[model samples]
Target: MNKEKWAIVTLSQDGVALAQRVAQQLDDKMCHIYTKEKYAKQNMQVFDTDITSFFRSIMDQYDIICGIMATGIVVRAIAPNLGHKSSDPGILVIDTKGDYVISLLSGHLGGANDAARLLAKRMDAQAVITTGTDVKGSMAVDVLAEKLNCVIADFTAAKDVTALILNNEAVALVNQENCELDGVVLPNNLELLETSRDLEEGKYAGVILTSMSRQKPEFAIPSVQLVPQKLVLGIGCRRDTPGEKIIAAVAATLAELQLNEKCIKAFATIALKQNEPGIEEACKQFKAKKVIIPDAMVQMVQSRFDGSDFVFKTTGLYAVSEPCGYIASSFGKCLLEKRKMNGITLSVWLPEK
Candidate 1:
């Protein structure tokens, strides 16, 4: 199921028509049509409260809010609720005639720009993107990070780097992971450094540093660290181990390894630990998928690694972390071998090459 919630808000009868059209172009399960009582139709939600109140109520509930009304109306309704760019929902405003789809708020990190462009194409309307980078036809730092599924370490640094790029200043890209730009065309002013060691101070106005480790090398110029979320964490905990302990253990392991928590994509464990509260809570807290490897699969991979008789007696498998991580990650290399902590053993897997 598409988990992203999209709210199509309309104020007038004509606006409702536009909203319905917008909803038709979006996933029906994810998109909702909301209008005033007089303008509401069957299967459409009616707002009994004032427009401002209604907008505020759904601000946190929806990932994208498309107001089928005047641009000024959306600005006024969402202004009070706006806090941070990364935290706020993407706000889009479309005219009643479907002439233009405006990317009003959270253009980059919130994905308003991309959403507006896609929606505009579907509705046969022009997309109005006002972001400096987009308007200038330059690559946006946040947009690149979003495409790579990376977490930006410093928003201020990202903004500074983006501004430098917009000003025609040279910026160095230290892509340690060889992170592909995919089909994105690079701005002429942005230069790619072969490695982090090639990032010389004062050579570029700003730098985009992409790496998995948090311990960054000291650089004189402003730099934005992009940590790709590509690692899978495999865990094996004793029966009845508390969730808090599992969480703490995982945190300590990441801290010791100088890895970002956002890099974890899944928490894999033996099938016996699938119902464990500690494993479930750890996955929930980290917002990672829970992968359960059956005992038979674990046995198949056990011969490749050292095993413990105690674990075999408990779970009918000699190894848990390594085998579970290996299977969960489609037989990827183990970056961190099993490390034991209070009643918990954990391992980290590298992303596929």
Candidate 2:
């Protein structure tokens, strides 16, 4: 995951210093500071004393707030303002002494839980996580797959496997070493068989079992396998398109292709023009990385195009456009395009493993 921006507010000089150290440790940008009595009036990286002004400035500048070195006063001052925004960044409180890190808001959804754990490790403090999912060590498969950018081929089998892990039961599998079993169960009895076929054919009544390879045994036993999906989709869309439309198009295309959303790793587009707010929103909504291409490349791609009235030329392979002619000519393959909407296009390109 890309590092998120943080605003650190501290009353003491020591707090400021600690905040700086934490920022450096996390490799995140620290935009402003709030101190006692005196507000340093400066631009870009400014410092302020007035609690309201400092908080207002923070509200405008950073995505997440890492409250360090300040206790009840800082949190209480900012608590009211935090309520107005739904997408407010994760709010974390760290002691000046650096003994503990607590995620005060947006703990699970906004990635505060993960951030707190990371900050704790860096600060050598305890990560105070109260989320049930983390406590149980059984993260949702869909959520995990979304965060990791991996696929869950068989949803039914995946559910059963995840359930076993959550219950902490031992599951038998071949090549267990390669799998990430952080929250999985392993069987105590490891009767080595000649082949995976033997295990697959034999029924183990207890927990889920799986194999790394695809050769199924002659006899059938219930097991789950984690497989990598090898499809990369390139997309093009009209300027100023909303994320919902693009998402709808992508989802529809994937459904048509009989593919799951987890198969997608990342998305790329020309960086020349302003990014469609919808596309940016969609990337965040889908937890997919959106890459914008350079302007010079967009111009080059435009030069090669011949057939469309809707001309959006960008250096990136994916050009957001409304015209089917332009979308078809622009991309090597027409995975999907806007039929009812004025502008939207998608192209599926498989990445080389």
Candidate 3:
């Protein structure tokens, strides 16, 4: 499920029953039902404070918030606690009678729009989505970015491109690297392009760029650059190496490759180095997932690349970075075969389409 933690809350007696029903439909491990002390049942949690305070208190704790009361009540309770769409939790509102499920806040990036549709199906209610792209049956750029595990370089440009697509204006799709769009059908307004070089200046209303490189092609029209997080970095470092040095080395390597650091999806290493502070700190600084490659997998894949006798003698594996990166990327394309600097060795891998 996209939302790991969900809070189903209501202020009225009727809402409590619907809230409990919603809680039943959701994953029990991730769902919690809450109501005021006067209306709360034995199974539902009672709020110790006011409804506004209770909503504000749990805003950051849950990935999704479902309100069963009036839409205005949910709005006022969440208004002060709202943040940017990128960081905010998905907010959905269901009527007390369960007639409509509304996508209230942080729709695309937060997955509220999808959640509303799914929840409405389970509740036998209609999903009320007002986003222009959804209403017009056009592709939402932010939703597409989320599906591709990408970050949009310019939010304004993304909005413009999405608007153009909704209006059925000509838009260009420039896929450079790392985005798996093999069989995916794009919007009718989007003209699929093999390269930006073929794009004529000012011909299209906007451009949707999918890339991993830091350097992108210049377009005369409004452009939205989608940088996919597809790079996996496998690292081998000496014990007790300071995190600062490891972070610097990674930054330097990414700069040399001319790739955006944000594109790093994970930091992979042998299980032995997984506990190293340097590796852990680098993962934290880059906000990437930590992938601990077991020694057996490394051993199995070591023969595919150049073997290092010294590494095998020291770590019981032929090489660390290359095998770890290969396995971490699900045995995909190897971008950078092991590069060593100082006592550290590193490799980069990208998942093949």
Candidate 4:
């Protein structure tokens, strides 16, 4: 099923034992346990020692860390090396006694809260979620949007609509079947009347929820457009280039394309020896995964090149390339040869219909 990777670190023997059990419960493949003198061994990968090199080495490899057993010392030792907190992976701290679960870093942003809750349930312990939005049972659209990788166009309107929902007003809109809502006034006369009006009129006061990309009919309310923003960035760079130059080119490219840094879900390019440095650097800068294609595949794709090919080759979506005269010229021949270079070369696609 391709579960997300997680790293587990523990210092005390009891902590290490608990971590091993939790790893088994979660069916995790990569778990690094820090312990002394190998007391008891489980299915998880155990690293017997407290050296800084050991901690740094594991941190560099895994994106998320689920800390179990040890709390103060383990967190203190590893906290300094965790640069760029915003981009770091989820870090959850659990008590050795299996009584409480706490999300330390990337709590809501990186799914740490979710992970902690899930782990707590397995241990029959309390999931201590202190986030106000979740506790109030109101709409947490922004948090959901981030977790789902979707774009929310109108932030102010979203908050206002959520406020209305929390007031026990029946707002006209759609919702996921599994959505959590409390004190919702469903199918009231006022909501029904507003539902028939245009969304721009501000008559409706609810959110329109759908996984599909098609726009809904006018509902006389402010709509928060929820569309997945994953994009594939196609990069063409010189051989053996430094990472800085590639990052600069990508920054310029994103700016030209009117795209956010987070919009880029992945990177794609033809396999080139010199392109590795730049590609690696760009991945780190954008926090994106790089998918390198064989030269033969690149050639075949180029033969059928369209501006969308730039994005498709990388992310399997029709995306507009960041406009760069130099980049365009270098790849123009392929695009033109395939008769794919229309006036609108770059285009972003919503998910499949």
Q: For model 1, what is the C-alpha lDDT against the true structure?
A: 0.86
- State each candidate's clash count: 0, 16, 0, 7
- Where does candidate 4 stray beyond 4 Å? 1-3, 37-61, 70-85, 139-142, 151-228, 273-275, 305-353
| Model 1 stretches astray by more than 4 angstroms | 1-4, 27-29, 50-53, 238-243, 270-281, 284-287, 292-296, 303-319
Each candidate: what lDDT? 0.86, 0.55, 0.86, 0.55
* Worst-scoring 10-residue span by lDDT in model 4: 335-344
In candidate 3, which residue ranges exceed 4 Å CA deviation?
Answer: 1-3, 27-29, 37-39, 42-57, 238-246, 273-281, 303-318, 339-344
Better of 1 and 3 by TM-score: 1
Candidate 2 Cα errors over 4 Å, as ranges = 1-3, 11-17, 20-31, 35-64, 69-91, 102-147, 151-167, 171-232, 238-247, 261-267, 271-287, 294-343
Q: Put down candidate 2 lDDT per residue, 132-180, tens digits, no spaces.
A: 5467755544344333334445667656655654565434445321334
* Candidate 3 C-alpha lDDT tens digits along 54-117: 8889988888899998899899888988777877899999988999999999889887998899
RMSD of 2: 8.5
